[model samples]
Target: MSGSVNMDMFGTPLQKLFSLMQLTLVIAGLMGLVLLLWLLFRALMPKKGQTKRGRKGK
Candidate 1:
């Protein structure tokens, strides 16, 4: 292979900035998705039964 390397592969500053923004957006989206799933799980769970009269020992 030739020793010459393509400088274009390094990309421009603007391109790099855009890629960073995209990565940030993806991470934020995943976090929001996890939060939504957790909320749904909590909502679907059954609540524990409690006696209205008070403690049975009393």
Candidate 2:
């Protein structure tokens, strides 16, 4: 059989590879951003069991 290159899901082999790489990078970046935001929020917010000292009687 002659050498025949079959098209991938993204049309050609090169395109498919590039598309997959781009998708991977995008997902990784989003996950990193989410983790950073979560950490920032946790750092800024107070713990549930602790309350402000002067606000207890209010």
Candidate 3:
């Protein structure tokens, strides 16, 4: 049969793999955005009982 596995995986298998990779990338991007937002909030907002030193100084 000159056995060919390469010919078989080119169909649904490849499509499934591509879709999985796309989903992974999308989830990773969402997580990165959430992390970025959290970091931005932490950097911009004052901690408990602490005022903005920059505002106070100015």
What C-alpha lDDT values do all the predictions have?
A: 0.63, 0.69, 0.72
lDDT of 1 by residue, 1-58 (tens): 2222223323567666776798899999999999999897556543434434334423
Which lDDT value does model 1 have at 40? 73
TM-score of each: 0.60, 0.59, 0.60
Residues 4-52, model 3: lDDT tens digits: 5444545568766886798899999999999999998778765645656
Show the colliding residue pairs in model 1. none
- Best-first order by TM-score: 3, 1, 2
lDDT of 2 at 17: 82
List runs of model 3 lying over 4 Å from the truth. Answer: 1-11, 48-58
User: What residue pairs clash in candidate 2, if any at all?
Assistant: none
State the TM-score for model 2.
Answer: 0.59
lDDT of 3: 0.72
Quick one: RMSD of model 2? 8.5
Per residue, candidate 2 scores C-alpha lDDT tens digits across 1-58 of 2234234443677867887898999999999999999997667556745545435343
